[model samples]
Target: MTEPSVPHAPTAAFIGASWLALVAGAATYLIGLFNAEMALNEKGYYLTLLMYGLFSAVSLQKSVRDRAESISVSGLYFGLCWLSLLLALLLLLIGLWNANLALSEKGFYGMAYLLSLFSSVAVQKNVRDVSLVRQAAPAK
Candidate 1:
């Protein structure tokens, strides 16, 4: 019989880049928020959106990976993960569309928000891959 395949660990460069992207995206978004001359409530809304988006993205990624590995994931939970991520995106878009910000500001927030969400998923995947590779390694 053929041996089971081993999951390869992600390269150090990839891991570092994923982390850097996550940090840069998050930091840039937060800094923009801090510098924006908006009302406190508006800033809170954007902050909450960023947090929600990141959490949902990471959760969805984990759920998808688990399903791919034949792990038992409840259909309801998986569906919610997808719904939450979509909702977060929708809310951000609607908020931006209605906000009293300039076009460049809106674009900045949108780009940073997307970057953060994407990078968070990448970071989560790298972490999971590294864990799997370590677990598959035999003790010396």
Candidate 2:
């Protein structure tokens, strides 16, 4: 089988920045949760949504990458990946809508959550692209 035509590897600065964004967004969100005065259940719900969002974002990115490379991703699995990502977003929105936090606080959580998700997707793409390029390189 022919190897896929992988694109150029991600730059060090880009990769570093991707990692930094992910860590910063996630850390800030978690730290906020830790210091919030909300009930334990509410905190747990937000934390779970954050985890779920990150995972689903990564999963969706990988599936998209695989499809781009002409790998055989099942229709059902692909659909599920998209569905999970949407569900995570919907859950976050609904939770925030009914939350007792201030508008600014809700905005803060929303922006940080989105930033974390976007960075995770970028990081996953960078990882897969870099790995593919390295695999295609000739090792002496």
Q: Which residue pairs show collisions in model 2? A: none
- Every model's TM-score: 0.95, 0.96
User: Candidate 2, which segments miss by more than 4 Å at Cα?
Assistant: none
Local distance difference test values of all predictions, in order = 0.93, 0.93
Residue-level lDDT tens digits of model 2 in 28-120: 899999998899999999999999999999999898878877888899999999999999999999999999999999999999999999999
Lowest-sum lDDT 10-residue window in model 1: 1-10
The per-candidate count of clashes, in order, stands at: 0, 0
lDDT of 1 by residue, 4-111 (tens): 356789999999999999999999999999999999999999999999999999999999977777777899999999999999999999999999999999999999
Q: Pick the candidate with the highest TM-score.
A: 2
What shift in Å separates residue 6 of candidate 2 from its native position after superposition?
2.0
- Lowest-sum lDDT 10-residue window in model 2: 1-10
